[model samples]
Target: MAEITASAVKELRERSGAGMMDCKKALTETGGDLEAASDWLRSKGLAAAAKKSSRTAAEGLVGVAVAGTKGVAIEVNSQTDFVAKNEIFQGFVREVTGIALEKGDDIDALKASPMAQGGTVEEVLTANIATIGENQVLRRAKAVSVSQGAVIPYVHNAAAPGLGKIGVLVALESDAGVDVLEPLGKQIAMHVAAAFPLALDENGLDQDTLERERAIATEKAAESGKPADIIAKMVEGTVRKFAKENSLLNQLFVMDGKTPVSEVVAKAAKDAGATIKLTDYVRFQLGEGIEKEESDFAAEVAATAGLTK
Candidate 1:
C-alpha cells in the first residue's frame, strides 16, 4: 500500500469536492491514488454535498442546551425542510448541541471537538451528509454563562424537546437560588425570542449597525431642513431613542408592554430576595441569513425530462 500524506489527501479533497475525512478514507482505500479516490467518492455519492453546497440551505432547526449555569445554541441548516424532520439529523444536532455546551461559542473549536458517540464533529458531520443525502451545515453557535445564577434555555414551538425554529439562552448572574433564577431566566429567554433585541446593551451593538442607524437619523433629520446644530440635536435624539428601543435591557418587556427589561430584572430580584444581574444572552433563528433558491416546480420538472424530444 502506498503512503497517503496529508497533502495528498488535501489534493484529493480539493479535486473531488468531498469532505476532508472522506478524502482521506478514499485515498487509503485506493492506495493513495488521487484519481481513484475521486472516483470512489463519486461512486459513493459523498461528493454530492459539494454539488449541493452552492444551493441555499435555509431550512433546519435551532438546537439549545443548558448545563448548570452555562447554555449554548446551535443552528444546523439543510437545503430542504424534510431534513428537519429526519430523526438521524435531529439526533446529530442534539449531540452537537451537547458538545457545544462544553465547546463554548467558538464555531471552529466546536467543530474540531470530539463527539460523545465517536470521531470529531467534522467527521461526524461529513458522515451525516453522506448518509442523510442532504447538504447540511453546522452554521453557527453561541454560548451564554452566569457565574452563580441560571443560564436558562427556551425553544419556541419546538419540533423536538430541545430543537426548534427559534432558540434563546439567557444568563442571570445572581446570589439567587435555582428556584429563584430558573423562572426569571426563563421569562427573559422568552422575551429574547419575541423581542429579538440586537444586543444586550448599546456597546454590544456592532459599530456598523450603529453607524447605519446614525446615517438614517441624519437623513431623516436633513429632511426637516432645520438649523445645523438643531439637526445635530435631532440626530442625537433619534439615535438615543433607537439605542434604547433596540437594546435588550432598555426595550419594553413584551409581557407587559410597559416596563423596560432592566426594570423587570430589578423587580424580579427584589421579589425573589436576591441580587440578579442580567449578564448575557444568545438567540438563534434557524436559517436567519441564508438565501433560499426559488424556482417553478413545473418548469424544473419539464426541464429535467427531455429537451430533445
Candidate 2:
C-alpha cells in the first residue's frame, strides 16, 4: 500500500471538489494512484464524474477581422491576462486573424503562413513569447463569407480595432443593400452572442440533446393521463417548442422579443428590395467549456512562505 500524504489528499480534494477526508480515503483505497482514485470515487458515486478540471484557461483574447465579404475570428490563449494586454501579443492575434481569412481557418496552415513581419506565423509567435515572457497558444479560429451579402463582425470587450474577449461573425446571404441589412445582421449577431443558440436550426441540434429533450417531453405528457392521441400531440408540441427556443433563426428576436428571426430577415429583404437569407453564424467566447484550475490562494501563500500547519 502506498502512503497518501496530506498534499496528495489536498490535491485530490481540490480537483474533485470532494471533502478532504473522502479524498484521502479514495487515495488510500487506490494505493495512492491519483487517476485510479478518481475513477474509484466516481464508481461509488462519491464524485460526480471522472473529469479532471485542472487546466487553467482564464487568460485569453478573442480576435476578429473582416475583409469585404469574408470575415475571420480567433481566440488565442495565454497563461495570464497580463499577457493578453501585451502589445506584441495583441498585434499577433490581430494579424493572424487577417491571415486566417486569406489562408482559411486551419491552425496548421495558419502557423505555416508567412507573417506580415517576414517570418512564419509560428516563428513570430515564438519570438513574441520570448519577448512577452509568457506561454501563448492559438486556441481556435473560424471564418465566414458570403458571395452576395455581408459578413458582419462584432467584438465584445474590444482590446483593439478587431480583437476582444468575445467575437461573433454573422453571415447574411442576400442581394440586399448593406444599408438595410448591416444593422439587422449586427443586431442578430449580438443576439447570438447573448443567447448562445445551440445550433442554426432544428436539424443542426445534437442527436443526444434532441433525444434528451424528447424523453423529458414524453415523461411530462405521460403524466397527464390523457388519451394516446392527446398525449402524442402534447409531446410534439413540447419538442417543437424546444427546437424554436434553442435554434437561432427560429428563435424570437431578442431586440423586439416579438418577431421571429426568420420573419425579421424577411422584413429586411422587403425593405432592401432584395431577397435575404441567414446562411450561418459563428460565435466564440473566451475559455468556453474549458474548466479552469481552482486554487486556494491563501493556502498556497501560506505553504510557500513556510507558515502552513
What lDDT does the true structure give each of the candidates? 0.88, 0.82
- Which digits, one per residue and each the tens of the lDDT, describe model 2 over residues 120-170? 887676555546655567888989898988999888888778888789999
Q: Which residue runs of candidate 2 sit more than 4 Å off their true CA positions?
A: 1-55, 216-235, 299-309
Q: Model 1, which residues run further than 4 Å from truth?
A: 3-11, 296-309
The weakest ten consecutive residues by lDDT in model 2 span 46-55
lDDT of 2: 0.82
Give the per-residue lDDT digits (tens) of candidate 1, residues 1-309.
899899998898778787777888999999988888888988887787666666678888999999988889999998888999999899989999998888687899988999878888877777777788878888999888877878899999899999999999998899989888888878889999999999999888888987898999999899997999999999998888988998999999998999999999999889988899998998899888677778888887888786424
Alpha-carbon TM-score of each model against the true structure = 0.92, 0.73
Candidate 1 colliding pairs: none
Instruction: Find the candidate with the highest lDDT and give its number.
Output: 1
Give the Cα RMSD of candidate 2.
12.0
